[model samples]
Target: MRNLIHVLFFALVVSFSFSCKEEPRTPPNILFIAVDDLRPELGCYGKSYVHSPNLDQLAAESSLFENHYVTVPTCGASRYNLITGQLPKNPGDLSNQASVSNIANKPAGERPTTFMQELKQNGYYTVGIGKISHHPDGYVYGYHEPKSDKIELPGSWDEMLLKAGKWGTGHNAFFGYADGTNRNGMAKEVKPYEAGEVGDDGYPDGLTAELAIEKLKSLKQQDKPFFLGVGFFKPHLPFTAPKGYWDLYDEENIPLAPFAEIPENSSKASLQNSGELNQYKLGEEKPHLDRVASDAYARKLRHGYLAAVSYIDAQIGKLLDELEEQELAENTIVVVWGDHGWHLGDQKTWGKHTVFDNALHSVLMIKRPGESGQRISQVVSTTDIYPTIMELTNVPSQATLDGESMVSLMENPAAKHWRNTAYSYFRRGISLRTPQYRLTKYFRDQPPAMELYNHQNDPYESKNVANEKPKVVKQLMPIWKKGNTGIFKE
Candidate 1:
């Protein structure tokens, strides 16, 4: 009878051990979504016109950053910074060239290590879809098989529409001139859309979303975690979206550009140097565009831009819904970011180029599992994204990354020792943006020009107090120089 009792006691102990055993935790998957030329006009960003319910909902579930910025305002330059976690210092300003050029000329094994490459090294499957780069194929970024199934939007109207016999006009859209001679020379060619066709119907943006969904479904069947990048090309361009999205906003009801009243003491060079004054007019140069008469046209252009933004938001909503339906939300880390911001008549600028706040500031939303929804007002840069993903996935990064991990901030939004200021630079200028101040130094052959603004008092960046506050400029200059010490050293 004692032997029988011993056997029963052993069985009970085994059962208890089995019940208490911990299951292995699966590494979190990463869904990296990149949008081109998007500004901080989302519903969560306090903009009334742009309807980004999906992003706002994601923000509700994630950590939204209010002061996120990019290293550069151009697509290729900014993306290179994010992927490599390093400042872009390509010779000949090669960093801002189209992706195709960068990839083709990339030195063997010298390609800055990308986050996707690190993921692949750590045993995660990496998949890329859509305009991830300007490259003809996406392999340069490290996907094993760069999927090329993306749909082409209308090509240059001159080439695809007129020359192909599909449309009457065969001219390129008016992008700002390259030489600054015509001020309206053909920047690039774009296919003309039919009278009522939506931008996404023919463009690759919708197809990119479809491919992302398909990739996610395939990922669900596999046991391994994945790094899936979905890039959309809408809102970058010929101001096209489906007729349905356009109809959502009445042109008459569209808001006008916020009135910009230059101070009497402001330099004439500052006012005349506005990029908006020099944009292409009907695909040709009109030097008088900077004069007062162009205001009405500028208003119409802004309306089209806002409509494009809203349309892209709808497509984003579709992708987010799929994640929920597939049951991937709880296990996936969703990161939504714009490659860079766009300009809409701010500081006499119609597009990105200058190192102004409107160009350098971008929208960055991160949704990590188990994190409460909140806004992080700390200054952060695109370079931080790669390191953050590495920490979350438990993956070993092979390359030395320059960005500090924001995992601490993710766990505790009030975490201290965060960056005091974020750094941004272009070819001829460097900008230092902190929560309270912004200082810009533009280098020319002549004496360097400076602009300073107290963000606390002038949120619109309307005033330049550099002359009035020389001491502040002197203090910040060294700090900015220190942050950029290693940038051009190599």
Candidate 2:
């Protein structure tokens, strides 16, 4: 009987050892949410006026990057840099067709074009909804043309989906309105802002959220880890949202552009006309570099932007709730990133084609379960996201990337020996944002070819002190020149 008891104990110990040796650690799933033309102006970012409760909550649970900047200010180019993990190699790389013209047109080579494709190669079931790449529906077509069969970012997505709704096509749905019609078909007769009397599903973004939730439900049933990319289209153009969101704010109290005037000593060539906003010809006001919008009109526009933001916020909240309901939140790494920032009215501009801080600084938040939340102030670029994800997922990458892995910074916000710099390219110029100064060098032969703004004193960037601080420019020029990448080389 004593020998029998000893045999049972030995059997139990051997079984436990075998189980421990056989079990493998499961990698965390990635929920990547990208918002178009989103600026870092939320309650979590210290803008108490903006009604972004959902983003605020996510920021509370994640590492909120205060000084996060994009490589390019435009949508497609910026997203290209984010996916390819490379800087602008040529002039065409900085355009909106960077993805379709470069990656989609070419055959799939040995290297993956995007990090998502890398994840796919590493056994991740990748899915993309809405505007994940340059094209809204992951197709190659003009905004007014019929959707084509050519795919953008080929071999990247296992399933690329977009519910265009009544707009017919993804591009039309992108610039869509409350009604079934869109800006492309309306012949520039639409207004820039709309407060539709309908539910959340009245807009394309609503449908995007619903589809994303459905995908999440299905993804939870999959055996392998998934990388789900959900991109929201609102707050991008024709700022349209449900009336409930519009009611959340008072139009009278909305703040106007603090510095509507151009920067002193800054050349007009360094700025762009409010061309994107003025495309909506039916708007009540037209903003130009020299002409600023009236106070009432500016407030109205601000109210529209805020309403759209709140509407997207609600959609994000729905996604988060669904993630928790599916029991995926605990094992998923959630990342909410903005393609680029929009100038509501900074520097008398209303678009994101410039190299100013407002055009470059966007929203970036990352949440890893079981880790404490932090607000990282280190200057980081969108290119860094590629390596960061690779490290986070423990996926091996063979592609030559331009950005470095920021895992150390994400692990510790106040990390020592960290490079505090971000580079942005646009409008024939390459701008570098350090901890204290923003130095820009324009390739064009224009007056004030070099511009510098010290963030410590002129946070608004109301003045260019390049001539005033020649030594500072000389000190930063060598570092900023490295970002040229031969795009502006003669």
Candidate 3:
């Protein structure tokens, strides 16, 4: 009788324990969309004429950063900043070959920790597609080199993928046009812009988006949340897009850059004479610092760039729609960021590698599910994205990130104590953007070594007031020097 009573008591205890147990909570997923050479020209950034419906819609539900800056102006270095959350401190790290120059050379024990690596360690299915790193397709080698077993982001992703369509190789695709002729293949005889009557598959961006959508669907089947990175190549060079996007723009209506002349009192060292622009031997105009590019050709280039933007937007829409279809939008965190801004004839120069606003300022948007729209006016760096992602996904990471967490401003756009200064490095010089001025100081110890622009008075950046603003430079000099410390640890 006593044994029976004890058994009944134990059964009751087991039932009580089982009833009190809690179900494990699912974590939020991350969709990190990296757009190349995308400046703040979308409708969301108050550019009334640009057609970017999909990204604008994304901005409606995201935290739009009005003052976002990249650590480096070039491709590979800027990506290194985004991936590793560190600023470039050496000249070698600032090149387009930074993947091969720096990261690829480092031993596994001495490499910096990528946030994506942290996510993979913490049970997230990390995936990469297209130009997430320097290489157009995330595999290594030159524009014509064959694919090998080189991985850029070591230990970061479970699967790193690149699908180059008719263009053949990633390097060729990067410099390719609508008719499948790469600039290299054509011996630089390609025009600066081409609007071919082709479908979305006519460009590599479409194929990248398609691949990402497929990966998204597959990622949903996994038990853990995913970190999917999708990168699109467009508006970089040899501006090419489908006919439908090109039709949206009227060539005559495209406006030229307001500040087409070089800045007053600025040294020649601060500018490049559209060398990248001069690469295409078939271009309609030859752009030089002393001579202005033809207005007609400038309009054509802008038209092509806009078409590329719209094409990528349509591709982005496809990815977003897929997320909704899979019911993953409810718990996924979406972030859209450009590697760096492009100089569309601004500052009488073309291409990046400049410390000017045209090259430094880019686009950044972060959307948390159910979060209200907010515009963050405080200046933020690209490095901050790593910590922000870590905080957003609730992942535990011991990674030492160079950037601060942007979550406070994400919650409250006007949050205090937020960093108001942004830093960008190039060559031996570093540029600092504060609330009022942009100060650039060179380290070579030459004449006209410093350039300063007062943003309030000269919104166009047509003048350099460094010689006149000695007191201001004195105050900002330390801050400018403080930006030079993102040196990687061995």
Candidate 4:
């Protein structure tokens, strides 16, 4: 009887121990990356000539969003719309200073203070490196001013770092070249593009990749899941990359921008004056609404831009390779996004300040471990990325996400009940994109205040048929007004 009792007790102890043994459940890690002024001109996006094998491989294993659009065509505004998961609430929010001029002042207790802050509060290690916000170095500082302790997205990051290198401050680095000379400091005397004879490390983006790789290893040692953001500055302005990337392209064979003339019957207010390109004082040619850069100079600019794209692609490949090396690729979710598309001489413009497709469309690719590659052609907005991240990680919070998740579309490209429209605001113009149309309503215009383009008929948006297509305008009118509620001053 004594032996029987002892055996029973031992069995009970063993059962309790087995039940209490903690099952290792590693939550999915998120590797979120953002590139500045990158359009979907890569080989994966079917731009046959672009030498982007790294991004092509990524897209091959992920859900490629062919028609991704940003809320605002400019950088700061588009990034704000993305990080906050909201539309531009006011006209001033459409400027290039959106993060600093708009969001950095609000209190943390207020509306969702950045999705990163929410993730950090929910026990995830959140780290931001390089131009994650309006500021290039992830901190707030005046143009040409020394770095300050004031952070843009306060309380959002457990670690914020940047190797500014020879670029000095973040703002200066925002427009720096491979030789450590910046656009502003050089007094605009430097050429708008450069093909450095040095290696990849001669540029800031190479150093950024180095930091990201180190961070990934550090994050792996932690017991909790992490949200790591690595923002690359390239293909933005003062296009400069190593000579090797430039050699990858034949400058003479590089194609000219598809659309260079302004749309017919569109108001002057509908297009930008290309002043952003003008800032490159040494640019061989100036582009305008009525005139475009010389074809030769335009080809040179395109070649430089493509070289920068390939350089950034190599850096991205480095980070991804390290993720797989650390055995983290199977459990990590990878996202590669471009803030907004740039006009490569489209619409007689070279910058991204218009409501046109060249300025609004961007790159959005997502890779879920163990998932096959699929293409989603629906019109999705950058604002949706925040909610999609939350859904993927199963993290709960008290936030009302303005964007919807793409989980269903990721699983099935033909998913039903998906959003068929997206909205973007720039200057006084409000552009709405449906599956088959691109409509614009300029708040500052009179009687002919509306503009419409049937994408089914004119993909280049070369004509505004608003007057001819009253029926289509009537159908999209209500959507335009509804989209204007928070964006317009009224």
Highest-scoring model, lDDT = 2
Worst 10 residues of 4 by lDDT: 103-112
Q: Clashing pairs in model 4?
A: none
Pairs of colliding residues, candidate 3: none
Q: Which parts of model 4 are misplaced by more than 4 Å? A: 1-24
lDDT for predicted candidate 3 compared with the true structure: 0.86
- Alpha-carbon shift of residue 461 in model 1 (angstroms): 1.3
Say which prediction, candidate 2 or candidate 4, comes out ahead on TM-score. 2
User: Which residue runs does candidate 3 get wrong by more than 4 Å?
Assistant: 1-23, 486-490
lDDT (0-100) at residue 249 of candidate 1?
A: 65
TM-score of each model, paired residue for residue: 0.82, 0.96, 0.94, 0.94
Q: Candidate 1's residue-wise lDDT over 347-462, tens digit each?
A: 65556765667878888999987767998888888889889888988887877776788888877767778875777776466778888888877654433377788889778777
True-structure RMSD for candidate 4: 2.8
Per-residue lDDT of candidate 4, residues 121-162 (tens digit): 888999888988878887877776899998887788899989
Clash count for each candidate, listed in order shown: 8, 0, 0, 0
lDDT of 2 by residue, 1-490 (tens): 9999999999999999998895577888999999999989789999999899889999999988999999999999999999999999788888999998779877666333699989999999999999998899889999889989888988888999999998989999999888888888999898998999989999999999999999999999999999999999878988999999999998898888778888999988988898999999899999888888888888888898889999999999999999999999999999999999888888989988999998999999999988878899999999999999999999999788999888899887898877889888898998999989999988887888889999999988999999999999999988987787888864
Q: Per-candidate RMSD vs. true structure?
A: 7.1, 1.9, 3.4, 2.8
Residue pairs with backbone overlap in model 2:
none
Q: For each candidate, what is the lDDT?
A: 0.64, 0.91, 0.86, 0.86
TM-score of 1: 0.82
Superposed Cα deviation of residue 225, candidate 3 (Å)? 1.3
> Which ranges in model 2 have alpha carbons more than 4 Å from their true place?
1-22, 110-112
